[model samples]
Target: MKPWILGLTGGIGSGKTAVAQAFIDRGVHTVDADHAARWVVEPGRPALTKIVEHFGAEILQADGTLDRAALRQRIFAVPEERRWLEALLHPLIGQEIASVLAHAESPYAILVSPLLIESGQHRLTQRVLVVDAPEALQIERTMARDSANEEQVRAIVKAQADREERLRHAHDVLSNDRDLAWLDREVERLHTFYLSLRGGQA
Candidate 1:
């Protein structure tokens, strides 16, 4: 049988990665949509071939790898191009996510994604878990980690589903405004809760 799946999501700069790592520490298997998205467009993949055909070879690096930064600039600046890329890549990423999630041997598996709600990836899960922090906190964290300016971080936050929207869909919410100790404790509590829910439907 397919394992119980939790959709863990949050906006950029939120503590999704930290919470995901905490779950991993507890032996939970996680399928990250961001990783799946990257995998689908790797060199030698059919998606890469199609992307090259559409965007031209200039989209690739000197080493023949996809030039992700260039492509990111293009798509974010052009909505049509973004839609086209999403149309092509989303299904492939979904397939990869499903394949990995099905094989999870833990009591339950987590599908960790920033776009879990926006991309419809939440449909794959039995419940949704949202990692939340304040907008200012998100922007600050992102700017520090990515070395991005405040404007850039704010733009990213704006592009993602708003805090209210994410919270509206959450079956569980992990507030990440505190330190790692609080996060670990919350994760431990949730881990035990999820384990109890194993074999039960959402």
Candidate 2:
């Protein structure tokens, strides 16, 4: 049987990355979608070749790596282009995530994706975990972490579903605004909860 897989998601700066890290610290096997996306497009990978064929070599950097900056700009500025790119990349990413999950040794595995809900990948998991924070805090965190200005942060946030909609999809929600200790406690609680779900007494 497959390990129980949890889909972890949240808005732009809702601390999903931190929550995933916390799970990893507790010995959970975590697969991050962003890393998988990057892996699929590495210099000599098949995905990179397909991207180059579709978008042309102009999107490649001098090092022959996909120019992520250019690609992001292209997709953000063009909705149709974004959809096209997503169609190309999502299947490849899904395949890699499946492969990783197939070999996972943990009782549960976390498939962390910023766009888990938006991309409908949430349906593939046994549980959906959301890391939540207030909108203002999300904006502030995004600005600080990405070195983005207020407008840019807001634009990014606007592109995502609102807090209420995300909450609707959550099988578990962890509020991350308080402090690391609070988060750690929540993580511990969830670790116990996950263990129980997996028929383990830990």
Tally clashes: model 1. Answer: 0
Candidate 1: worst-modelled 10 consecutive residues by lDDT = 193-202
lDDT of each: 0.92, 0.87
Q: Which number leads on TM-score?
A: 1
Candidate 1 residue-wise lDDT, 17-101, digit = tens: 9999999999999999989999999999999999999999999999999999999998989999999999999999999999999
- Model 2 gets an lDDT of 0.87
Q: lDDT tens string, model 2, 1-202?
A: 5688899999998888888888999889989888888999999889899889988999999989999999999898999999998998888889888888778888889899888888778766888889999999999999999999999999889988777888998988998899888888899999889977852223
TM-score of each model, paired residue for residue: 0.94, 0.92
Q: Where does candidate 1 stray beyond 4 Å? A: 199-202
- Point out where model 2 deviates above 4 Å: 199-202
